[model samples]
Target: MLVFILNAGSSSLKYQLMNPIIKKVFASGICERIGIDGVLKHEYSEDKELKLDIAMPTHKEAIEAVLSTLTSGEGKVIDSINDIEAIGHRAVHGGEEFSASILVNDRVIETMKKLIPLAPLHNPANILGMEICQELMPGKPNVAVFDTAFHQTMPDYAYMYALPYDQYTKHGIRKYGFHGTSHFFVSNEARQMLDRKHNTRIIVCHLGNGSSVSAVHDGKCIDTSMGLTPVQGLMMGTRSGDVGAGALQYMMHQENMTIEEALDIMNKKSGILGISGKSSDLREVLEGMQNGDERCRLAVDMVAYNIKKYVGSYVAALDGVDALCFTGGIGENAALIREKVCAGLDAMGLVLDPVKNNKRSKVARDIATNGSASRIFVIPTNEEYVIANDTFKVVTESR
Candidate 1:
């Protein structure tokens, strides 16, 4: 079946057209800077890449452009849009109503609207994409695979805050971790690579511009670092990870700053970028570290330290963890960070083979030393595939 998966942002639309039955990505690309000078980049697996300069004033325009690309002779992956069996979307938040992917319907659309306050930056955009597709493909089936759904399994104790109980019950104000889709995909893939069953305990580290760690026990999320919002986890490229609750109040009082002002600092001007006073990109941090920049070295060390601390915390949460899997841009590509994080884990019976760890961009492989009790792996995440699979399941099951 031809499944088109979309991940819509405030000003961008990334899409993948895939024949899920054959597991082949026919065409994939993104439209960037919508409502401004736009860029359309499309790629076909047959070594064909197209870059177009166009005016995509809205997501509707972007969708129309994408449809044109699919039917065009230059990059035609299929005969017509009718060949698309279904459309899947990466909905960033589902509030408390959706626990899994669901076929798009009027009720789903309404629920998505109600979720806007919970995800002001994402849900509105997602709704826009959905509405555009509904107009463009009248009766076509569309699915919303939420990023928050996979984390719904978190128990009350794990997701709750110390705030007044009524706040949570009234406003749905509990932890709803982000990147659930990526964490879910990588955890499942890691289990398969380990030749183990779903019930095995695993810690999936999803590190990138945005990052989080999940503890999967019995194939369900037991705990995750992110809470209520994406800004609560391990230090991200721009977001300050976890911080003392009192700091916000103190900063506001001392500087006469508003909550929004403090939030702007926490969300945009923090993490490695804030500490290093350099670039947020890991590659740039590494370069500065190699050039003997103490601040850059400190930034790198801090990120690694935060990851290791989470690993230890997950171990305790699970009582004992079976595997530690790394996935995402930094997790899959940063060998230096991996080496540093695994340095003192030997006390926890987790050891890495330096030789194996040194190999860059290797696929899922065991990197643990001979005598380690736990295994460590590097598994790249495929959230798009997860959305596709969920979309296929929902559509087919309904039929």
Candidate 2:
């Protein structure tokens, strides 16, 4: 089936056209800086890419631009928007309402809106994408694949907080982990590679700008680093992950900042950027570290140390980890970070082969030494594939 997958952010929309059944990509690209001036980067063919400066005043114009390019413009891959069989939206928060992908309907849309409070930065954009797709592609089946769905399997103790029981029952305040799709995809790949598909214990490190660590046991999420929001896990590009509430309160009092202002600071101006006094991108941090920049070095060290601590805790959570798999942008390409994360872990049975770690590859492969008890692998995440597959399934099963 031809699936058009959309991951809409506040200011950007990432899309992919693919056929999951055949494992083929038709076209994929991103519409960046929506609501401001826009840049449309489209990859229609494997080797040919296009970057167009276009006016995308809103997501409506953005979608229209995408549709135009997909059908008739220079980057055309399909004959028309009709050529796409279905649309899949990357819904950021499903809360506890959905445990799996579902065909988009009135109820689904309404529930997604209800989840806006949980994922204020993402849910609205996600809903916009879905509603716009439904408007523009009137007859097509739209599926919602949630980032929180797969993590729904987390046990109560693993997901619940120590907060008042009434708080949870009243407002659903608990750890509904994000990055479920990536963790699900990569951990399954690890399971197959390790040939422990049925009774597997895998730790997935999704180290992107928004990073997360998850413990998957027996193909279900036992626990994940991200809590009710994406801000609770491993340190991220701009998010101050796992920060103390007391620190936030102290800062708010000293600065006389509102909750929103405090959150904006934590979510937008914190993390590696806050630490290094530089860019949020790890590439920059690594470059600075190479130049003996103290804060940048400290930032990198902190990230690695945090990842190592999470891996240690998760290994204990699963009783024993069969494999520790890294995915996402940083996880796949940042060799030095990987090495630092795995350093001094020989006692825990996780050992990285330096040469293998440094070697660059697009495919998933093990980096653990032969003597290591648990396999260590670098598995590139394919979140769109999971979205497309689920979209295909939900649409197929519906018919």
Best by TM-score: 2
**Model 1, position 298: C-alpha lDDT score:** 93
Output the number of the lDDT-best candidate.
2
TM-score of 1: 0.98
User: What is the per-residue lDDT of model 2 for residues 286-348, given as tens digits with 9 covering 90 to 100?
Assistant: 999999999999999999999999999999999888899999999999999999999998888
Q: Determine the backbone clash count of candidate 1.
A: 1
- Per-model RMSD to reference: 1.2, 0.9
Candidate 1 ranges beyond 4 A from true positions = none
Residue lDDT tens for model 1, 1-399: 889899899999999998777788999999999999888899986699999887899899998999889878688888899988899999999978999999999999999999898888999999888889989998889999999999999999999999999999899899999898898988888778777885689999999999999999978999999988889979989899999979889988999999989999998999989988998898899999999999999999999999999999999999888889889999998999899888998877789999988887656778888778989989978898899999999999989
lDDT of 1: 0.90
TM-scores, all candidates, are 0.98, 0.99
